[model samples]
Target: MSTTRTRARIATILAGLLVAALFAAPTAAPAAADPTTRHRPSPPHVVGTATVPVYSYADAIRESVWVETPADSDGDGVRDRVAVDVVRPREAAAAGVRVPVIMDASPYYLCCGRGNESELKTYDAAGVIAKAPLFYDNYFVPRGYAFVAVDLAGTARSTGCEDVGGPAEVGSATAVVDWLNGRARAYTADGRRVSAAWSTGRVGMIGKSWDGSVANGVAATGVPGLATIVPISAISSWYDYMRYNGVRRAADYPGYLHSYVNGRGEQACADVLARLRADSAEETGDRNGFWAQRDYRPLAGRVRASVFVAHGVNDLNVTTNQFARWWQELAEQGVPRKLWLYQAGHEDPFDVRRGAWVDTLHRWFDYWLQGLRNGVMDEPRVDLETALGTWTTQRDWPAPGTRDVRVALGAGDGVTGTLGGRGAQPGRERAYVDESLSEDALVAEPGTGGSGRLVFLSGALTAPLRISGSPSVRLRIRVDRPTTELTARLVDYGTAERIRYDSSEGVRTLATESCWGASTAADDACYRDTEEITAVTDHAVLTRGWLDAAHHRSLRFTTPLRPDVWYTVTVPLNAYDAVVPAGHVLGLVLGQSDPDFTEIDDRDATVRVDLGRSELVLPVTGRAGLPSVAVAPSVVTAPAERSSARTAPDNRQVP
Candidate 1:
């Protein structure tokens, strides 16, 4: 099985097991409290220059508390109390210096450790942290920042149930920020009310994967104190995590994650898990209110905080489309943001880009949290890593002036069809059956006859073409069945061998150690050795797009096409960075089904392609100076919240 397929098969199990990983002081005057409510000034009154260190980690203060929230998700709860473990420079207490807060509220704290060390939080009898995960505190505490590791709302020494990415999850994190900023209240485990002293109330949330997803969700709430967020490889929608388009993925994955995150054995969260499975709409594989509540993009316009988004282009664990769509939403909101795109798979930039990641992150924090005069904002907005392991910077992503270049598919010698920019000549329609097939099986040799798929090829290119963004497939076709799944892959066909991402998920780690930042005995900013992902092979599948013929008109509504009718649907391929060398050819594969996912009904359907009407649209990089046309939406859709789904003309993103 392919590495991606394997991960999808055991997504919840691996996500639960691999969840490890990864917070500050106040400097400026606190934001005003409501005149109706009483308020007290924050602790540590003095402040220092942003460029210099103001506190000492060796003599830092450690403490823990329970923050009270308004909701009670767990049945046995009396409202929710979030556990917060804090570490900050002793200088703040000794000399009355103030610092900003950096927090990482995570559910992984109790079940899986964080970082390469898999370090879980440890506390002394006084309920103070004896050990915290990663080096966020070790490196930043001395620099006058308070780092707090929160155990989310549940799972670790806190009250309430873990609702995955539901309302409770988002509310819990925002409540903590509220308390720090003097808007909400917290208490000691002994039932004593506590307040967040030693804080400027300026908070910046950062984390990877699940931990980061929480940050994104919290910021979407438009929380006041959250000044900025850095979410690495985070999921924008939980639905996208478990399902793709309108197809149900590997079975039992969502149930497994919910139960595992509860960490109180199967019986403890069986009801919650059961409820999740029931509400998922897995039977119809359609988008519902359950998934809509967890999606953050809709809340993007309300976000008041700056965002620094980062994700691996090769990440299959949390597919790239989720990030692409979310990032675009943030851009449309006109939020102050920066982006870091890497070439590696499901790994953190702290490990992938190391030196640069740290330096940039430090400046980012200093500028936002400390109100520093640093020129961080003046720098380029996009820091992207290409497939070759090299780096490039641009003013913005989608690289400013990209042009959508269309390549039409024409009739060819029976098996492989011709694909190019030249207008396609009218030709006989090609047909294919819907059958679950592996990527390799569908993309055999050029002349290889296949009953399950159709392969179309573009002549060897005389000049290299760099594609910076997603490519949409516009196809006009007729299918016999009411609903049939369509899978399209934009591939680079070359004689030279390439890395098989299916083998090791694109990258592997070595035994040697590569230190990223400063370190101590219990905590180190360094990590195990690593190399860029590679494996010389023949052809490389660049990107893929999927659609359900019946639901092509709308992801929420099932509108199957009439047997003899010809309809047009534009499918947006998953986002990726690919450069076709001068001598390599580009191939497009039209397959009925991908074995990687379980779409259930495997009914065979014959599809007839309208050669003259359909075309492959490529976002050719460095064509900004060229005349650019307005790009179409990923798919046609309707306002999805209502009972009957209709075409939502503005809804464009579809995969």
Candidate 2:
């Protein structure tokens, strides 16, 4: 049977099996003969501790306290109490060892508020709360180290006016670190000395999300004694998070700000939410003003700590693009940095894959803070592509061995398969409607479904295709009218299913052509006549682009600009995992538009997909074997001749 027919048959059988399983379940279960016989097993032991050690600072070991501090250090206005959660090895005292200190500056207003205090108090009184200072304390603290969790100024017991992401926040963190270093030698009125002079003062900083961003922000100050930083899913730019792709994301801004400022309380959040809502993009668009004052990019080169950054590929709320941009910029500036990309949405680091993430962070911390020979630095960088169920390692970000293979689109007899076939050549092109899609039109849904929008399949591979590097698609075409939107997606086609890998989009404004090329302006008539009088330059037109397909794109090409004539747009495909399985195909999908992504539409358009003119270029590396495989054995036996001979003799005697 043909591959298509075989696939259809397998799909049918699978559907039938699913339907049968749904109905075949037992309606009722047999009751136990005796209720006492079915006694439930006792739950796992719930380890409880009064105080957990978070981290060990230079001379002293900082710890988490169920008790509160009596005095406020800074006299900036707010009276407060403070407590530090310390984590350290039990053998530290006996070994006279000094572990690295990792201080956590808790987010004000959200965590460690009055309600949080009440909850912590209740848990403490009940003797059930664990007070390790590390973010993932239950997982990291026990491995021989110390962690400190501090309530920022104006929250918990810390004093001073609350300054979110400002210098005051940094000061508060530094103050805690200072306090920790003197813990063993400091004296109270009663003459009790507190300090950890035995400790070696190696300190590090780590935070997740808000904490992560603050850590990055604080690291920019070039604070002394700060060793390393591991910022995960951090917000580097506030403007980028609130406003994406030049569009204001009104829905998320207010709610997010309110949640952070008010601690989810109506009274506290009302004023902040109102102020944020009233803010205008025009007033803050330029990063050189107040926004620039808040940016950490300026401090990128100054951050002395060894940094490890991790972000999810499918993080919708905090898109990975910003992190990618930061990584690229840092790399260009020669900053010591490492990055991990995992297949996950927002909160991916907190999921089952969190261990590996934490492990990576721990390795970095150990190497920089403790000076351990854990071989973490020796390991190749890891890229976890969950969709393909594979973990790839490379020496560099983009890896190596990427080949650009362009597959041209062609007009065929509606039979979907590989690109090579007898179809329209160079000069021949076909046109299709570019109106709003009808309800019945086959369109991709949001999120994962967007992968189905445009489809191209590669021929079955005799060997596993290893692809490691950036991929790009080049399309040469023209729309029936002026402005049109285009979306392209790359897919890994299995023997049975097509899985989306990556995608990008571009908007072409054809009519506004200057002497140089096409422009973004809507009015073409005004500029068409003065083409010669006014010098037309590349700046007046928009050209080849790279966008998240969900986002925007540029101008300039040595090739002439075409109006009704065919024009080519080249889009970069984000780096992805290679090693496509043998007998499976790779697919490239191109469409006029994708509704899931907001595209800039400027014309009442009729568009055509010029197959002969359009091509999907793939960067194919050398082949690799399947990562793993399993097989079963068969059995055989001889016949029993004696039994047959006895039966024949008996029959003859009866006859």
Candidate 3:
């Protein structure tokens, strides 16, 4: 049989087995023999053989089953199937119980299907989990909630392989919820009261990376049943993911495409990848067209579910700017949202920090689905200030009192005063040699030397410097070449070690007015000067400008383009600090290119600093002797009433 036919046969067999089991299991109570009474709703038949005896809510629920639903919900041309796992309550307690439901859409294809059954079950049974190394199912099922893992429509045992975003995927998710409700009723032995369990109807969603993206998409449907969502490592802008800033992200694109197409033995994904690969750079550049169609930002307002967006501070694959855009857009629409920034990487999902994340999810569901009198709703909406690893709550993201600090770059050797400048002065420029590396270095990995880079350090801070908000840099530079690339990185220096804080890089393509058309030439002149012209090279360039480190010149005046043109580039530093302790030092590292990041190569790339024209700007927050503040200890409120004490209210502040 063909793959589709084989899958269909398996689904049919599973459904038949479930029906048989339902018929075989003795009913707890019998209804009247009257046809009318028989016509009334009977306990849902438990179709599949019970691999594990049904237990109480306390023991832990773990059962894998395939849910059958009409492939075509609306008699549409297309059809699909949704596979789900129903994790029952652990202990054998009362029947009529309302438990929270967590619907996790798996990112890895194997984890949700038979291919990964053994591994998933091991984790499910063993209760050990990590994001990068292991599948997510192991971590979720043991958490005392019904975890529904959906195989989506086209992967593993499901039908239809068109993974494109639309009704198909959404319908699959909806169908899984319906199936879970039925299974929950069946597991409750058809008790009328038990069938009315809280989770049988209420459900929430949470996932990381691809799973997270799906959660965001499903939430956008405004599905009434979906109570809340926690999307981590999810990019809001599809355009940004496929094309960075604006340029096609050559390095990551092929790998991602390959994973979706061939990773799961799903044939349909091959076509989608083909189309994506066939699209030309120009075709992909039109953001308002098909690219926008794939983006989630346009659908942000459509998402009615409360959301907790988590992103890493140093996610090179998906920059922090993307998260900033997501937060800003959601806020602009007045969506109930929370933002969590961590000092980690893309694969941080499976990290131990996930325990805290899972706890947060549980509290959110308890508040929304259980209608508990938990203070989850009243807790600060934002958590985690990057510099400070500790959890800090806030009313909103980019909270009040966020200050911007400017750090200057100047020509300098190891630790010399020769290139000293007191905040913005023009001087004779000196160039530093550019070095290139054979291979790209991992951004998070320390101490792999590469080419065209400069490092500058600030004197040890006298007092604890807590910098929050974005970091921007202004630099004076001249390049021997017509066009150059520049990269800047902010580093927090420890006495024994130096760690990367945040970085941004970009490239500058020189403009030759002769190459432009009459209309284009006019526009170019309007933006660019003869000595230093700024032309509308391309939006892609601007998008790449988000991280390009092509050129930097003194900000003093319009320096003429000579043998080496000196121009100043002002770069924004988005990442900031809550507090850099007094003992630590602040450092800035500049490079022509970040090998571990983008492959922007510039030979003979030399950055000259007129020390007389440089200064390092730091944003300092005024401190009050560590004020005493009361924080809620738990995510949810306790059952018993505690002493009524109110803490001094600090008007939700952010700069």
Q: Identify the candidate with maximal lDDT.
A: 1
How high is the lDDT of residue 548 in model 2?
25
Decreasing TM-score order of the candidates: 1, 3, 2
TM-score of 2: 0.55
In candidate 3, what are the lDDT values of residues 1-655, reduced to their tens digit?
7999999898778755554432222220111222233344322211121112233322344444444444543233555544455554544224444455777765344543221111232234333211111222333333334556666665544554433433445556656665545542222212122232436455677766656766777776655556567777775655556543333334335334444523335344556445545542332233444455446666767665667788766555556665676677677776667777765545333241445665665456555444443466567887773432356776765656654444444333332211112322467444554453211221111222233344454454557766655555566666665434455555444432212322211112224322111111111111111121122210000011223333123221122244445555565544443555664445455555433344434355566766445544444456411111121011111122221222212211100
| Residue range 421-520, candidate 2, lDDT tens digits | 3334776554544332321122222112221133334455568766654456766656554444554455444433212212111111234422211111
lDDT of 3 at 646: 24
Tell me, by TM-score, which candidate is best. Answer: 1
Error of 3 at 510 (Å): 53
Task: Kindly give the stretch of ten consecutive residues in candidate 1 with the minimal lDDT sum.
Answer: 20-29
| Candidate 2: Cα lDDT at 399 | 50
lDDT of 2 at 493: 42
Candidate ranking under lDDT, highest first, comes to 1, 3, 2
Model 1 Cα lDDT, one tens digit per residue, 53-162? 44555567888888888888765558888899888888776666667899998888867887645678877777778778877887788777889888876678877777
C-alpha TM-score for every candidate: 0.85, 0.55, 0.60
